[model samples]
Target chain A: MTETPVKVLVVDDAATVRLYHTSLLSEAGFAVEEAANGLEAVEAALTTAFDLFVVDVNMPKMNGYTCVETLRSETVGTPAPVLMISTEDRPGDAERAYAAGANLYMVKPVSAERLVRVARMLTAGRGIPA
Target chain B: MGLVRRNTPPPEETAAPPSADTLLSQLDDPDPELRREAALGLDGSAEAVAPLLDRVAGETEAAVRDAMLTTLAAHDTAQVAEGLAVHLASDDAGLRTAVAETLATMPNSVPALLPRLIDDDDHDVRVMTAMVLADLPHPEAMTWLAVMIREDPHPNVVTAAIDALLPSIGPEHHELLRGAVERFPDDPFLRFTVEAAVK
Candidate 1:
């Protein structure tokens, strides 16, 4: 039997960053979809069943914290793990991410190896294909 | 010295839904959630847009301002165009990026609203405006790119304009492209952008 690749959504307002993340995840055999901001991300999440969400913090229409909250809220109510990545490393940033329902919080320029490893670790035993 | 603790009753707060008037007033509230809720409350009415644009100009909170923008984006009214123009020069990069995305979605509104932003004091606004214009088939896009390449002070804006102009730059505009190259000879990135575009 063939295995379905784990579906992931990569959301960011920056075109360059979105492309970079999408390429990295796509190259690693994960299905990737891109959203320009949290508004679009929420819209996509409502329609599509993604296994994971890689979200950026500061965006135009909706920021990351609100987006994650909505994902956890009854509006979408998807329990899929969310990984919040942003340039913001200020006090309480990680706490805010956790409060908003993100499973992991990472800063920008995260090492490629670390990103893939953490992604695999978090999704392991969640019934996704190896 | 005696330390005294006085018991005080909690102040009574009303739970009534805010009226339209109250909502508009709350658009400037110190709390972003309050401002966002206020904007959402006012979003369905066409009459509320004028006040919404006013709030958009001074609203410092991103979520609140984005709420206002989302409301504004739903309509294609002249008021919306004006609102977009007002935010084109915003110091907030995120807000400006949002405005650019909104403008890109409404390509018909671009020609009339975007030119003014090309000359904006903020170079990021110019770059973003140019990038939005690049995506469309509008004739004004070429003219604006030429103007930006010739006069825009920032190399980034000029480089973006050059990138936008590449798809259609023909023999007639070659000199104009060369002029940009000559104008910013010291900027390797700008020169490289022009050279790549011309090639």
Candidate 2:
């Protein structure tokens, strides 16, 4: 039997931003899933098998920070790495993501190359979704 | 501490001939564009990965680093896989796109290494993931794509999956595709693709 590709869930409010990041990460050899809002991202995470997560901080419905926080509260034992993508340049943004249980935080507009590199790093040793 | 020869990059080092390693030596050149050009041009060459890996940490300019990432994309050499992995983590869109193209063509570390990209948060990365997975046709990819077409909000990703389906999709997925096309008439690509597939 053939194995499954790792699944990444991307959460963002903008259609274009979601498309761009998804295309870049997918091109770089990733299997991508998209959520238009933070609530959608959270729902998907709870049900689907995801290797990694790339979320936006300022999405409609549930924001990325809240989504990650919710996931941390509900995942019970294993917590997948959360790579938060945001436009806020403040130094505290990183702190906020960490507080919300995000493993990493990136500022937008992050390049396609940089996003791929980070995905590989976070998912490198982890138990990726099949 | 010692006076290093400025003109030449040393005999033993230049053996690979014409690449980023040699180009990196010129990054310090007075010309800004030359530095940028060299950084971009050295990508993916066997000689460039080592030094580029080091320089990536220190280089601050987005323009120059972007060039370096392009150069890195040219690298399919196994010698640079580790560093290439590092670039894969980068947040730069251009570099990620380059790496995706590069990964699609090259022999990656393992079939196992391909999955991480599929589930990436970036949409381009996901679309590219379909392409790279086509190179190997992992089963998990088909499942992920199938779900995306069903649940994802964007039509582009759905279209990408339809394009990737026949080549990378395994035999067990026929039923899934059939149901999918039946459910979503909006997807013309899948409609045509499924028609072609049955043929």
Candidate 3:
């Protein structure tokens, strides 16, 4: 029996970044979905079941922190691991991400290898194709 | 009985509109609605630029901020552009977006300040400015974007410039895109973006 691919929702306001992350993950055999902002990410989370969320910190309508909080809130209550990637590398940025229920926080320009490895580690045993 | 119309020149215009000073004070009112009204009332008052910018820095209410920004945008002066440009560094994403949106509308005023903003030490600010340039209707936007694509050191900021250039890409820009690819040879995303645009 062929198992379903692990699903990931990549949220970013920049279309190029979204396409880049989507392409990387798709090439790695994950079913990747894209959202332009936090509001859209929340909307997608409501109807779709994603195993992971790759969120960007700075976005219009709703930011990554608020989006992650909402996903963990009763409104959505998604238990999927959230990996927040942002250009903001201030002292408390990572702490803030964790406080908002993110499983991990990474800086921008995260290497392609690291991204795939971390994503695979986070979604381990979630039916990702071998 | 037959109706008779009596008009006495609308009560002789009893109350003159509030002065700019009066409206300026009202910006501090406890009621956000009053603050919004005050902002709107300050339109075309050049001296109000400083105070409106001060209010924007701390304004929590979105409606009031929008009102202030709208009032500022009407000025079309370098000071207004400079005042708005400072907020691009704000940590609040909503405020940053709002400021960018407001700045984009001031094509005449914002161009003078673009160089300094694009050269900001913070890469995020550069990225935001690049995005703003994409929406600015000024004729020089393409030149600014091409310079960024060829010279900006950061991949994210350069990527934003590349995205801005995509709408108007031409054969003339192919070499610039190739230069960007060469500048960041290891960045797959940048290379992919250049490939997509050149294709």
Candidate 4:
């Protein structure tokens, strides 16, 4: 049986940022879907069982914090590792992300190599059936 | 909360085209998807504008808000502009940016919304407001941005103002930019912007 590529959701409001992240992850053999904001991300999550979520913190409708909270809640509990990224480097932002169930919190303009390395490291053994 | 997807068939998609009343009621549906669908279903009904604007103001879901914004943008009315203006001060940067993008697309909407947005207590919102203005043909965005450079207390907002003002700067605005450079001597980026503006 062919091994299925790990699936990831790339959520951000900026079109350019979504494209950048999608390209990087697609190149690394991950199946990726894009959501323009947290609401879209949540809607997509309900229909799909993704292995990882690369979420942006400050989004309209629902923010990354609330999105993760919902995902961890009974609403769409997948327990998939969440990697929250944001332009905000404020002191409490990361802690809030962790408290909301994110596995990692990273600042924006994250280097491409590091992003891929981190994605790979985080999803190493978690394989979902296609 | 239990994640419940309301299994009821959407009223808007029922056999007959949904009446305005049915659509309006769906706006209050428990599912965000149903609310978003209701917002989209109200398109092209002039009678739907006021009710839609009211729903937009109370909308909590971003997807639903986006649907309502799309409907409002389709109709250029004072009420629509007023409805859009309130989101500029939203804590969610994405929502604020979405409202800005919507304003940029609707020319008439920009003027009415700018003053409040430029003066918003959140400097970040003001910064975003300036960024939206930068993309428009109206000089008012630049004009207010120049004012922001001089009067706005936050360096971030000022820097955003300078960035928006730079491409359109003229010799007539030299003194204003120079004053800004002097106002924040410690802001290297602002100094660089002013130097570029003067040049």
Candidate 5:
């Protein structure tokens, strides 16, 4: 029997970034979906049982930190692994992402190889074939 | 007694509009609703810009902040744009996004400010400025994007400029986009983004 592909949601305000990330992950054999901002990401999380979330910081209406916090909050509690990506490389950016409950934080311009590798590693326990 | 209609106007209708000073004081009120009303009431008051900006820097309530932003945006002055631009460095992502949105609405006031913001030492600030340029309706937006795509040192900032340029891509931009791909020859993402834009 074939195993269902691991589901991933990639959220970003930039259409080009969303396309770039989605294209890379989809080609890497993961099922990928898209959201424009934190609010949309939260709304999608409320219904979908995604195995992973790839979110961006500095989105309108909502932001990555707040989105991760809400995902981990009691309202829409989901323990899915989150990978927060941003252009911000400040001293506290990673700590803030972790404090908001992200499993990992990466700066922008993440290479395709590293993104796919991280996604696979984070979801390895979910039985996704490497 | 026979039914009779009172001829006097209602007290609410006769009340004087709140003074700018009263509204300014209410910006610090305990009730958010009152603060929001105060912000709304201060719209277009030149003297209120400083205080309104002060409140915006510390205003935690989204509703009040939004009202304040709207009021501040109505001024559409360089001073207002500069005031809002300072928040782009905020740790609060939401505030940065809000400030960007507000800045996008003040095209007439932003041209003088755009170059400085795009050239900021912080890459994140530059990226946010690129994001604003993407949505800014001014005709010079494309020109600014081209400069950023060509000159900015950061790949993320250049990619953001490319994103802003994609919708309006033309023959003139093809070479520039290709140059960006060549500039960052090792960056697959920038190459992919430029390919997607030019093709």
Candidate 6:
């Protein structure tokens, strides 16, 4: 049987941001989900198993850090691989996200091409784990 | 540490037409930093670990995988979760302890994880495990703490054992610290901590 595409969850407080991230990954053939904020993202992570999740640090309900914290703490769920997106461009922000368990922190204004290249590289050759 | 400046973009990329999954496909670009950055990017996200692991497993680069693993280890992804289980079983004492310590952070994993440190083959693991458990206020764990104080071979273990005991020690455990002081008389850290405990 042919395999299904890998799924990704895009999370941010901003609808525009979610759509943009979803576009980058979806065109690359990844199935995509969206959450308006970190809390909804955590809820989505709890119920569905996505291959990757991109989160923003600043949000009303829960921030990116809190979202990662929740995923790590809740054991029964499939933990989404966390990529932190933030505009907090301070030096320590990336370090803080890493410390809080973000896999990678990307500063804002990244090009769409770079996003596609990065997603393609990460999901390559990783078949669904049984 | 203001190394970079940025703008607030839309939280998600909803504005763009959906793109293909070729985000990191150009990993072969000439820049080694690209490979390194690709490794970083591939970490933690489900879409990221498999390729990074392949890069680590196949590519000759020694350093690339560490960054990837660090990122993978941060999230409790399915791959990372399995890796955590294997790491707990690792024979290397320090690595086992470190893995246990990391796994201990998640409350959902407390049952499977807490016992590893208690019965850990390494003294450091045992001591650290005891320290972690002291907060739970388990009496049985305290008994193991006392036993380790009375028995571990390392001088630092003796002191660490004493330090672990300090959190919840009672009158019955006084003899254990006293005995450790005698066993590790040359260890000033132990001697001081024990002397303080018994007095």
Badly placed stretches (over 4 Å) of model 4 are A1-130, B1-16, B57-60, B137-139, B166-178, B192-199
Candidate 2 accuracy as lDDT? 0.63
Better of 1 and 4 by lDDT: 4
TM-score of 2: 0.39
**Which residue ranges in model 2 land beyond 4 Å of their true spot?**
A75-78, A126-130, B1-199
* lDDT at position B172, candidate 1: 79
Q: Name the best candidate (by lDDT).
A: 5
Per-residue lDDT of model 2, residues A15-123, tens digit only:
5566667877787767899998867987787788788889877543455666788888855323788899865445576888899899998865565667788898888
The regions of model 1 sitting more than 4 angstroms off are: A127-129, B1-199
Deviation of model 5 at A34, angstroms: 0.4
By summed lDDT, the worst window of 10 consecutive residues in model 4 chain B runs over B188-197
Chain A vs. true chain A, TM-score per candidate?
0.95, 0.89, 0.97, 0.95, 0.96, 0.89
Judging by lDDT, tell me the better candidate of 4 and 5: 5
Between candidates 3 and 6, the lDDT winner = 3
| Cα TM-score per model | 0.48, 0.39, 0.84, 0.55, 0.93, 0.38
| Backbone Cα, N, C clashes tallied per candidate | 0, 61, 0, 1, 0, 33
- The CAPRI quality class of candidate 1 comes to incorrect
B-chain TM-score, candidate 2: 0.49
What lDDT score belongs to each candidate, Candidate 1 first?
0.75, 0.63, 0.89, 0.77, 0.91, 0.59
By TM-score, rank the candidates, best first: 5, 3, 4, 1, 2, 6
In angstroms, give how far residue A119 of model 6 lies from its true place. Answer: 1.7
- Show where candidate 5 strays beyond 4 Å: B1-15
Per-residue lDDT tens digits for candidate 6, residues A1-130, read 6677788888865444666678667776788899977779877877788777787765544657767777777452454567777544555767878777767788654567776666666566644321
lDDT of 2 at B160: 53
Clashing pairs in 3: none
lDDT of 6 at B8: 70
Q: Which predicted model would earn the best TM-score? A: 5
Q: What lDDT tens digits, residue by residue, belong to model 4 across residues A4-119?
A: 78999999765545766787789888999999888898889999998899998755556688888888889898888999986555567678889889999997557678888999
Best by DockQ: 5
Task: Give every collision pair in model 4.
Answer: A61-B62
